[model samples]
Target: MPVLTAECDPRNIASIALLKKLRFEQTGYAEKNFDYGGIEMCDTAYFELKRKT
Candidate 1:
């Protein structure tokens, strides 16, 4: 079986809702440092959907 994966910004409620509506399950989240302006830590939400046989 195969799987589909996606990553979205946790702060974006609309995107999160959209993913849920599409039957995507939230696997986990990760936080990493980003260099936007100077330096910032950002959290990312992970989602995945298993293919139906």
Candidate 2:
């Protein structure tokens, strides 16, 4: 089996904690944020979770 990953706002402490609780691991990070609508966030953090085999 493979794994799933996601990118989330680095400023969201609660979301980060929840992902960790869900067995996700920190995988990658981006210092520059993407422009959304008309605003940009601090940064993006990546996470990954391997599927049970």
Candidate 3:
């Protein structure tokens, strides 16, 4: 089976590096509004991950 992972958290440098090391590529992405403490915000970013062979 193929595995997929997405970086939805903010400013995760280590995770980005690890994904790159694992040969992950940026395919496509999407975002939506999230409410926290009565504030509306969204996690904006591109998707990255590797597929298992």
lDDT of 1 by residue, 1-53 (tens): 89999988899999999999999999998887433465677788899999999
Identify the runs in model 1 with alpha carbons over 4 angstroms from their true place: 33-39
Q: What is the lDDT of residue 42 in candidate 1?
A: 75
Model 3: per-residue Cα lDDT over 1-53, one tens digit each: 66575654345677667766777765645465445457656554455555657
lDDT of 2 by residue, 1-53 (tens): 79999889888899999999999999989887766667654578999999999
Give per-candidate clash totals: 0, 0, 0
How far is 46's C-alpha from truth in model 3 (Å)?
Answer: 4.3
Worst 10 residues of 1 by lDDT: 32-41
Residue 12, model 2: lDDT of: 88
Worst 10 residues of 3 by lDDT: 28-37
CA lDDT of each prediction against the hidden true structure: 0.88, 0.88, 0.59
Provide the TM-score for each candidate, comma-separated.
0.82, 0.82, 0.46
Between the candidate structures 2 and 3, which one is better when assessed by lDDT?
2
The better-scoring model by TM-score among 1 and 2 is: 2
RMSD of each: 1.9, 1.4, 3.2
Worst 10 residues of 2 by lDDT: 33-42
